[model samples]
Target: MFEVGFWELALVGVVALVVFGPERLPRVARETALWVRKARTMMASVKEEINHELDLQDLKQSLLEQKKLPNTATDNLNQNILRRRQATEILAEQFEPGEAAPEKEPHD
Candidate 1:
């Protein structure tokens, strides 16, 4: 995202060399690179999570709109079943195999 030219990078390198000296510059650069990589990875993960949440919200909104419209008993029952199936699938995706899922309570 930065528009740093070759000269700008060279300038920064020169300053870092002068400040950190030859003895410690390599280690400093390595640590800085590691931190940048970690930050980039974390940012990517956050972006993925946000997109997933938005998709779920869209699905919920559409389901609500569908319920608001006039529909027969069969349609409503089918929609309820579909919603439960979708929700269970979503939950299953979040857990690894061998992990315990939360126990469901009796509805009535």
Candidate 2:
């Protein structure tokens, strides 16, 4: 990402060794690696949080759509009443001998 090459890295290492000395250089390197690992873990956690929020948003949208369905409680009750009335009419017709079946009840 930094466009750093092998020669550049070697030069930096030589400079670090000269400035910080060998003993301190190893300690500094270890600390730098620790910070890098921590940064990566934090980034991963942030990404997961974002994805989780997105999933929640999608679920909310689907729930909103479901709420907009045409088959509401009143509609379902009306449909049930209509079906029952039809069934009763069909049954009455079957037993009417030669006469026609009665009219169905009004839903309202």
Measured on C-alpha atoms, candidate 1 has an lDDT of: 0.94
Per-residue alpha-carbon lDDT of model 2 for 1-108, expressed as tens digits?
369999999999999899999889999999989999999999999999999999999999999889877568769989999999999999887878777666799998
What would the per-residue lDDT of candidate 1 be over residues 13-80, giving only the tens digit for each residue? 99999999999999999999999999999999999999999999999999988886756677899999
* Model 1 residue pairs with clashes: none
Candidate 1: residue 85 Cα off by (Å)? 39
Total residue pair clashes for candidate 1: 0
Cα RMSD of predicted structure 1: 24.5
By summed lDDT, the worst window of 10 consecutive residues in model 2 runs over 65-74
Reference-based TM-score of each model: 0.62, 0.57
